[model samples]
Target: DLSINGMWTERLEDSCEKPDEHPTPLTKQQLEQLVRSLILVEQSQELRILAPEIKVLQEDLQLKKANVYRSIPYSRFGSNRDAHCYRKAFPYLLAFKVSCQEWGQVLLRRKEWDAVLEHSLMAWLYTSELPQWDTASHNALREQCYGVLAAHILTALQHCSLEPSRGHELLRRLKMAQLQSQSIVPCIQELQRILGWAQHLDCDL
Candidate 1:
């Protein structure tokens, strides 16, 4: 009788603690509030991660801008030159360089073979603005930057595993532009040499 009573009590407690067959419905306001709270939490988390990235980006941009400004010649252009030519060219040149570097970095990260080819061609377009010499030294810093840009393009082309006809066109334009710069024979020669190497790349795909 004692054992039977214990068994009966256990069964009663089990049934009482069991979940209901039908669940209670949440109110519309309650649902909305829950969603809003979740959104706030998610946004707060994203802000925490993005804030530091944004700060780093701002610092990098300031450094790049300063480098560009330093490269500009403060002396006025020749008597025959337009007074505002340098002023007009300065900002555009800086913007172009920054865009080129950032885009190159993106291509390096993506390793998109075709895009790498496209970037390589785009790089030549910017090369025109890079005079062999500017402000003191061999422009070693600038050249290194361009070299890294070139490497990224090369790596992307290699990893993308595809043909780069579109990239070929960009190189063609660069070659033509370089040819037109006959006064700067060395620039033309250097560009031609680079172009030759770029043209012969065997894409993986």
Candidate 2:
């Protein structure tokens, strides 16, 4: 965790030193990598370095939106709410996916069984949320996070990997990731398949 924090802090330093035409817009891959770093820091249950970084991201995104909406009449008309949503969603999504992945990490560290299954479900929900966004980066990140979390959940759950919270606690975490992706793990798919089979003959999750 110290290593993760140190690396990101260095990346954050490099990012600050660079003077691009605009703050270098974070690419899908970069944002995902950021989330991965956030996850590592969180799982270690150590320092709180991510908050300021998330603020930087939010401020940068807001700046971009202000610039974008100014020239684009259609956006000003509020007809492109999806565009607005997509712009802001990734931070929240990254936070969400990483946090869940962190939870799975903690459980794996603890060797908790049923709770791990629950955390696995939480990861599945995160991935499923990914496709709802129309952005191409989101689509790709969805697939990327989906694949990673699937393997993660499977390995952890093999058998501890699994599932979140009610609204307030969740909103707090979003504040933590500066706000934050989603896709199914096979066990979730398999669980659904089994549930479907059970409904065909009387069983459930």
Candidate 3:
């Protein structure tokens, strides 16, 4: 079924000439179906086989402009609403993000930077989707995740400066997060100073 979804994307891209003529929007059920498919696909140990499916889902997500991160669809889980509801309710989308983060840590432990960046970026995509921006716990998690994100960019910058492709990729994402997230992790100041060619760290001044 995901393969069918993949083929549909290829067909849609080839056939549609105008924005208005693009494929119909996926129904709520289809959205959930596709999101669930990706979550399961990424969980597999056989990433070699599942990689294409994840790529298809990512492409489909971009084409649709479908944001599973922001809105929580409560009707999807009527059987045990209370169980899923934490201080703020956790949606299927949050589960998808958390799943990505889990796999990302696994990749990080193996020092697979590209793979780590892919999943870490996916997980970072949803950090802005948390319901309460000013809440204490949310603020803490946001800072922590952004810190890790900066480390990813800085590490890439340190290693990939000569071949700057992936470093630039991480740099772009870092700027986006710096703008989008209301606060930055403190250590990111050092990164900014380096980028600015400053001679001294903030502590020295």
lDDT winner between 1 and 3, please give it: 3
Per-residue CA lDDT of model 1 for 54-156, tens digit only, reads 3333333344344444545566545212334333233323343444555455445544555555554445444544544433344443454455455554455
lDDT value, residue 124 of candidate 2: 48
TM-score of 1: 0.36
Worst 10 residues of 2 by lDDT: 173-182
Candidates sorted by TM-score, best first: 3, 2, 1
lDDT of 2 by residue, 74-167 (tens): 5454444365655555454554555545655555566655455445544444445343544455456556555655555455435532233322
What is the descending lDDT order?
Answer: 2, 3, 1
- Candidate 1: the clashing residue pairs are 161-205, 162-205
Most lDDT-accurate candidate = 2
Give candidate 3 regions above 4 Å deviation.
Answer: 1-88, 91-97, 133-162, 165-169, 182-205
lDDT of each: 0.42, 0.45, 0.44
lDDT of 3: 0.44
